[model samples]
Target: MNDLEELRDALHTPPGFTPRALDLDAVMTAGGRLRRRRRLATGAGAALAVAALLVGGGQMVGGGAVPDRPGDAPAAARPEVSTPGRPADMLGDPVPTGLPAGTGEYVLYGRTIDDDALPDTTFGMMLAVRGPAGDLTDRVIANEVVGPDTAPGFHAVQGANGPGEPTFGYYVGPATRITAKYSGRTVTAKQARWSADARVIFFWFAPTDGQLKMLTAYDADGKKLPAGHNVVGVG
Candidate 1:
């Protein structure tokens, strides 16, 4: 009791000291402001790091180290052929029926086949007509056949029907003989004409009449080809 009473007297307030109440609301507001500032600084640092990563990724893409995919390969080139022999406007005009001016009763018909695997390339222009005996007749005008390597172009069997008929053209290849059976008669390739570009051979032929049957192409060895090997037929 004596010691506690002495300590209390020593701790007594000095003269003119005033006691004041604490402001709890002001202290809480100041603490909240400090926490918000810390959170803002953390968010800004994270945003800057993400922006740097994106810029680095863009630079890597522009470095050209990426390999080309299969889809990015270039397309194959197309075959080259000569311009059409006849005028475009003269295609469907009717032929005169008589005299020196009259060629024949014919109409223009064109057929083209291009196959790289089979190595068969042909572009033919046929003058077709209905015969007096109710048969279909086809006369060759311009025929172009591409060869394998240094071989000559394709040739056609010449016919006996005069100038307007299909004639034989020239070609060089393993093929030695070409025969066509039409109207109960067999026609064979005769003469050959070299192309202006020298890449192909042209063959003219006489008019083929009656129900057209088949065209058989042969190598120099005279072997009958399989059903569709270099064989041309009416479809």
Candidate 2:
């Protein structure tokens, strides 16, 4: 053995020192406790990181952070677009049960409520959103008024008041494919189920992509559909 190994052996097996019997059970129990502690610490740290992400800025969406203020930085950290998929259950004060529309990174919950006696605003469509972090923000968008037969087509509904906030809206039609144009580039809008009715759908464009110059809806057959009476933007 080398010098270091020889020194370790001498210290471990010193003469005239009778070592206690090995306690395999005790050693295992201590190891288990240590492992449990490590697991708890790891879990706490993960929770803290998620909490910080939510508290630091209220605009994170689509699996990335959104800058709190404009000119801070463009939202390049976010995905190019949220892939359309089944909406996952989001954590909220009163977890929204309405038909949510979004990908894994973000979800949009909307419901048309009509109850004057309700504590919260109980009129028009109540729209709430949740970011990738899995908690719904306090912000909610509600239309003051909506008529019974009002079928507003694709329209610009800004989710929040800043420059880089998301602009989304609902559509009631037979469109299965929706596309929006910005800066002469056409981008497919991410869509999700808004209701049992296939015609009712929710869609949105990426943040900080600038206002959509035009939006077009297409049927499953790829044929362009005529804009509804309440179409928003250039049809």
Model number with the top TM-score: 2
Tell me the deviation in Å of residue 148 in model 2: 4.2
Model 2's C-alpha root-mean-square deviation from the true structure amounts to 24.5
lDDT of 2 by residue, 7-41 (tens): 88888886795878988655544333222211211
Q: Tell me how candidate 1 scores on lDDT.
A: 0.35
Q: Mark the 10 consecutive residues where model 1 has the least summed lDDT.
A: 33-42
Q: Distance (Å) between predicted and true CA of 189, model 1?
A: 3.0
Q: Residue-wise lDDT of candidate 1 within 1-235, one digit each (tens)? A: 4698787877874657665667755544433322211121123332232233223423322232432233522232111221234433232222322212133244333333222211333433333443444232333333332233224433332232333334333344444565667767887643332333333333333445543235555665897543232223221
Clash count for candidate 1 is 16
TM-score to true structure, per model: 0.28, 0.43
Q: Which stretches of candidate 1 lie over 4 Å from their true place?
A: 1-164, 167-172, 197-199, 223-235
